[model samples]
Target chain A: MAKYAGYQSSINKAVFIYSPEQLDYKFSDTHPFNQKRLELTIDLLTSINALNPSNIVKPRNTTEEELLLGHDIRYINAVKMAGHGKLTEKQGEPFGIGTEDTPIFPNMHEASAKIVGATLTACDYVMQGLSEHALNLGGGLHHGFKGRASGFCIYNDSTVAIKYMQKKYNARVLYIDTDAHHGDGVQWSFYDEPNVCTVSIHETGRYLFPGTGTITERGSGKGYGTSFNFPIDAFTEDESFLEVYTTALREITDHFKPDVILSQNGADAHYLDPLTHLYGTMNIYKEIPKLAHELAHKYCDGKWVAVGGGGYDIWRVVPRAWSFIWMEMTDQALPTGNLPKAWLDKWQKESPVTLIPTWTDPENLYDPIPRKTEITEKNQQILEKALLPIRSKNSELI
Target chain B: MLIEEIMKTKIFTLKSDNTIKDALRIMRANKIRHLPIVNDENNLVGLLTERDLKNALPSPLVKKTVENIYEQNLEKLMITNPIVCHPLDFVEETALIFYENRIGCLPVVSGGKLVGIVTTNDLLYTYIEITGATRPSSQIEIRVNDQAGTLHDVTKVFTKHHASILSVLVYPDSQHEEKRILSIRVKVMNPLPIIDDLRKEGFDVLWPNMPGINRL
Candidate 1:
């Protein structure tokens, strides 16, 4: 593997925060949000020799006290009861479980707590200078609310991790999410805080689940101008997706200049992802982490923490897309040509669909979008609106 | 929903003789746009809005004016005998009145007295809540024949799955005049099973019937 572009070849610049227990946060075998993506991604990294065994860190279970940072006491108690099969479907309904979305599963509380702790572990590694960057692929449950779970998210790891950073380190954190769906839980968590800045670029709420990420949702009260949402139109391809992503992220980061950066990397925006309508390919994933690496070094002294979010195409899309972040963070060049034949040969049999055995997706992922011109224009308009507060503030200083 | 249920009852009123400055102060302090002018007996006389004040006052670019418009009498600017609604009036009718009259607010009156005020913002928020976009839910759309019992037929599938329906709306299909599109937002994120059930029931479940669902 070649060293990444314009980066020093450090032995361990980032840590792989994971434990097999994170896989226990499963809903069901047929559920779209599968932790099997985590296994595939780890294998891809390991096969390329990009993931260092010395840097892999096992996570601890989140203390009930830490879970309290981002959840209601009653919700936590209810989750505990439901985990042991003591809570009934009727009792779990009000808490957003046992529904078609998040049906009750065994040991859900223990599993969710481990994911939360993994995110916090990554945060601690970066904020405490133990590592320059960290990746917790099990975290990024962005739809979990204060008391309810939605969108297959049980306990919002990113929300708890951000609050933990604030309370423990007193660090001004910047959260960046590029999932196909809106990061509603994390956005609303710090909607009124001035210190934490959240930026989400997703398919517009008009056609996505948990629809509430309009540009008008800028942080309220003193937190005004801190929250930014770039809800691009559906069927947005890689070029347009990267346009809004790179521009908004750079502008928002330049304005906020936080002490640390936390990115929620959800690969569901891929063209093959059955859940989302976005047409992003592996191209956007390459730039997604490259830019995060550049900005973390530029602003936060390489203090970056990333977590996984909503990606349904675990077999065909998520493995390749998520592996880019580790490669970028570890200063390893994006693998080209065929993936390690051994990795593909092993996983292909288990994969329901054929894997793209190469570094790049096919030239023609889908038919050209008819509304490409109009969608790009509408996305540009949203980008301008989302940047208005920062632009005006910049002009005021001038 | 009725006017009284969602209307802001913490009334802010000013006497008819009050100056434009008084109205501006009240609106600025409370961040309200509409204010009702009441008589001594608390009967609604006129209404004043931020827009009317803006029109009456000189522009900020105009540094000097011979007469200060802020001190002008409210009687000269307030809309006299402004359209009002009853406290018991349906919100939908009030919304229609708002659209038909091209007005921003309607003062709720009962027995010929000022009760409360409802604004365009309030009505829009009510609709937002009714649409269930405020909650975390996944939406699905199905195209069905433009006939009665179609909605019932579609909802039966959702009922069998015990999926809580947040909101259900009927929209006209743009290309097919003989068909109607039924949009439903359900509380569950994994709407796959319900969508599958709808499709098996012979309804064309659009999954995400939107600007991009059929285009690409």
Candidate 2:
């Protein structure tokens, strides 16, 4: 238990990242992603008296210079001028502000910048050693790229944070992403960088949308053997999820010895999520921050910054899962007690058709993943192929 | 009911190069009093406790560095052989070991390797009664291609036998990729053997416990 102190106190030091400006960031009314989701979490924490204003920090906007750290300069300029305006040309496809997934609402640039700002603030807290842990639920836009945006994400907060940590602190960073979808944007940006060890465990790209987390996509040049991907089959549950993550995390963290860990926590992998087939519930989501916090403390003297990603079941699941994240960060786990009457009353008024569960569903419905299955075997082979050059090389320049 | 339900997966371990002070820091962080020291190979070497650290410290006047403290022959401070267990250790026996030795934790092992560690807290967490101790008298065995939800059919058979399973363990058959052997222990009120009853119900009862299997 003494080894847990690194995490215990670190988890206690988390600063909840938010901004009143988050209300301007809604994508569409048809989509479940909106500002009220964050408000619900704040309300829940406030009602439970877990909300400490001292621990809350408003997000900071990234300057165009910092934005250029991972993004194209032209892209930044386009976003600034667009300002909730739509982009229709295929050349502007990467800047997904005009598409169906990413609509150009009013204050589009400002709202996206706030999300990036929240994550950037989280990174600053960890980098400066002011706080060992911080979380921004509005970030984790893992699918964004340097010149383009895809998958309902605009700015790649994780990539920007990584660049900031590297450029500012000169510290070795281990970026572990736990979002359901592939961390394609983050991966592509650091695919050739050595100082950053990227390990992503997600549902196999096959049989899933935007499928890209194949095992064979290991980094090239000096960054060989630095990128690791564990693409598990669809419908994976809690136990198997834990197994794969534990194995990957233990090995990768030992190999990397990171100075700070930036994790993209996406709650969309929950069984209730409409988009994914993975079956983890609130328990798994809750367990992750605790483990990540523990591991960060153990490996990196408790330096960690967690950002929220893709979770669409706003009223029913996202708020609850992230609240558990808040609870984990505070070192006070949310109990099985009934949801506060006031919160539930407000939740019903917010979403009329959704059924709010009183307690966390116990079943993760997990089973062992077959290592020898054709799909897994094929994926392992592909990953091995991608990582072969890395394994053979000695050092990768970041 | 079984140790599998209540074992901690993360264990507290120290590398050899780490000082006794370092070990103590880890122990304090985890709120644990014990640490299992391992070499680079992850092989267990010795155990250190808070008592060892206290004893190793010198008098107040002689301010010594941590390296100097270790150089003062503190090698003799650790407990050499600590008790360990497999992940599948029975809960009753594990609890007995804790009581008998007055130890709070048992480092779980698999294939002579450290897979996880289970403490009293883990035992307590697993003891939450979601359902009563339902034991099965009928031992049903089957061979089929191992796939997800393969046990669903066998679970259905147990439901028909009016059996409540107390514990279940799966062991893979060495020669077959498609086959796995599962043993289900169930709780039954009647002394009458249900092995034959399950066999009559078309289950392949290859291995049945002899009458009077130890309950505790």
Candidate 3:
């Protein structure tokens, strides 16, 4: 039966984290990353009537000590002083505050801390069972390490929320990332821990930036084999991605029995993204969240948190792709064809000159050959080799 | 700008044969105000606005049986031949029709097929929402060359000016296949000073609110 999942009684559960303070944390003028992304996303959703006012959740400013929950105290102090326009002796460079990638914008600590707070709030809603799903579209800074920053990310919000979950609820968490770039900081922060299962699939570090998430770097000490990485070839298409992702995710969820699932829904994996070589389409991107929604219902009782990360082709791709994701999370009726003309015109007027794609699903995009059958065979070997049976075999935190 | 550029493509419509009661129910279910009435072949026949349904009440003679009265005059009341446009119609023409007609919506028809629809409210709302016209600030436009470092430098000026960028447009320039001319619109007070700052920094800035620059 071709199922048309008619509009379900949607529970409003989206969090939009905006602060005038975040206007400070910009890298460069020409870079694709900016506060404009959030503004455009919010506008696009609102213009399409996707952002229901009742469902819109705004952000709160996180305190200094609250930031110290997952980050070092010294790092927190460095961020605070940097926000006051006072660069340390090395230009506040050591703390990754005043760098070209992570420029020390005014109110740096407050802005970055709120990102942590936003993700933590989403986690709280799910853990508290306030909603079936939670989203922090503004809070997927997975590139930030515990001590320093890298890859345009300041503090790792995912790690902060994971620690909050572990400490506050004593919950076992599973973190999954399909960003074209590896979630290095998130992996390393939980590398030696057994309770957290970190799985990242990206272009092998051999070719991309921040070269980590190697096949061999499966956790250490008591957390051996808990971390999984599949650094596939550049331009790895969607079919292979779905195959590997679904298999690995299912095996880990079945084995670890996590209480919650956190996923980084990065759009950089699209073929058009200039930053990465992956050729994932919105079709493939939409499926991941839909499947995750189901898995959350089956396994975690619908406790899922999704965060937006990377996508450079802003006009042509990012807005539509992320809107698809948000629609899936909210279980709203999906709009067909390119964005509404009213929206496209407004988007073009605001951002004229860029080619505004007219179709929701780009009709002329390249389709990846179906390789699920072949990929599933390889994925099983990877899963067995990477996911150690330590969780079920020994209940103690060995 | 073609009608395809400004019309709403995603819309819900009803057939002429569908009962007013059923149509009303569908409209209520979808939270929609207008329903395009189509024939069996899906040709636009008429429209049924919420007001139309509401006005079709029972008279004092039939007040004793409201349900029966509603059943009697269901299909007899729908407004036929509502204003519409073809997908190829110019957006300016549609805007004029909307202004002169003072109607909220116009369905898009091509070869008598319902392609899409546009509402005056949608256009007005889009304008206000995107331009940030409601924010009480002048709009400044900067003509940027299609280059890696150009946009970075230009936006940096806005960042320094302490003016929030309301919206930006990367006008698709056919001249430079390698680079695209990006025209950014930022909302701020006194754009001349920032434009001068940009000029000093060797950037091509267009201050629309200035004497020579037209608002278009």
Candidate 4:
């Protein structure tokens, strides 16, 4: 725990940073990375009475100066021009706009900036000691690059927010990403920064987009041992996913000893996620934020900021998965059994697929994977190999 | 790719008159194993390697050290007539040369001047790129009959999806003589739609395959 743990009366447990403006960062009607997820998640939270006016804080638009901390000026300008239908395909191609993955949409710049600003707003509340933690459902654009956008992400909110925390509070920030894809943008942003350690556990890039985040990609130069990646095998089920996630997060937090924890809580590893092959279920979601909250209290004096990332199957998967993050944040008893009747009743018409109807996924979501044992052994080996450096270093200290 | 494209252009050289110690220091500083011994006109004269340096010096097993071995001229230990390749040679050709000669690198020469060097690591990286493993893409393997237009049929599915094809590698299938395995990498997060189209086209999708498990 931090020395500031003694402050009790002034700091709130957590603040929910969001606004409807965040829903405008859409690519198209059928794009996979949807901001409607933000609405569905907020609606579920509100139905359960987890959200209120006191806890809800609207997001602001991050300035060009703030966006530049994690983006190139030219790329930022290109996004701005592309947002207003001014940039051509040829010109926007260099900036990773006007493509099938991230096609240009009107007000793209304003939408992306608002997401960055929401994350920054979350950071300020936490770092200013006004809130112990914050959640920005529109943030966690992890694949957005410094000079280009890829994988449907525009401006990387996590990277920009980490930079903001460093510059504003001069604090050592630890970023934890649970997205199905690599958090390449934020990982590369601080690949050589010793103070800002990043830990990402995602599906192996063997067949995933942004084929990076291998176990060998430790930080380089003076920042060696700061970056940790656990690229688990595809079709990895809930048991194996939680094993690697909890073990790696515990080891990395102990090794880095950061002052704050910024977690990118992408809900795309579920079995229903159309983009990824990980076979995670609602169990992982409940535990993901639960552990993040515990570790923040243990190491950071509860200074944790959570952000949303890739989660397709918006109807059945995202709402229930994302609600756990807020429920965990406010110290609500983790819900199980049937979901609120009104919440599911309101959104079932909007959802294309039949909703799961319960707080948890049904038993035996899929047929048992034939190679579960081998996959578990392989993932366990990956965890050991990824932690070898820190383990050896700690042993040397002893 | 040509040797000129992938080869390291910065040549680290040692003269024939330079001492073995100078060769060793250059190798140690650059973290290189092979040193191109050159002349005043920048022509490749010989090749000196760390193995040769190790062979010349006294072994650690022996208590007495041969201190003066470091002072010996590099020409005595270097291979005076090392095989070289032209800049225009294909990387595959150079790879064959290294394999046939059992060497680790090739000295790329043009117009009687040592222009660059190609190491095993460089060739290996080219192979990785050829497999399209370096890019942010997903690979799908298809078993196709080794007939003309078979590749065209398989490629049309990706094109229909507007999925950028990074690289395609064709290899022989061990099970069937007339069949070939086509490994293709495409830049898309959700390849499910593309895979469905390929199956509908009657192409055998061998990968992203979970045979017994149910899929949505």
| lDDT tens digits by residue: candidate 1, A65-89 | 9999999999999999999999999
User: Once model 3 is optimally superposed onto the true structure by TM-score, how far is the C-alpha of residue B140 displaced, in angstroms?
Assistant: 39
**Candidate 3, superposed: residue stretches over 4 Å from native:** A1-24, A366-398, B1-216
Which candidate gets the maximum TM-score versus the true structure? 1
Best by DockQ: 1
Distance (Å) between predicted and true CA of A293, model 2?
A: 0.7
Better of 2 and 4 by lDDT: 4
After best superposition, candidate 3 residue B103: deviation in angstroms?
88
Per-residue alpha-carbon lDDT of candidate 3 for residues A84-147, written as tens digits (9 for 90 to 100) = 8776536565666554456666677777787787788788777886666778777778888777
Tell me, what's the RMSD of every candidate?
Answer: 3.4, 21.5, 26.8, 3.7
Cα misplacement distance, residue B32 of candidate 3 (Å): 76
- Interface RMSD in Å per candidate, to 1 decimal? 2.2, 23.0, 20.1, 2.3
B-chain TM-score for every candidate = 0.91, 0.51, 0.60, 0.93
DockQ of 3: 0.01
In candidate 3 chain A, what residue range of length 10 has the lowest lDDT sum? Answer: A1-10
Tell me model 4's lDDT, rounded to 2 decimals: 0.88
Better candidate by lDDT, 1 or 3: 1
For model 4, how big is the CA root-mean-square deviation?
A: 3.7
**Clash pairs of candidate 4?**
none
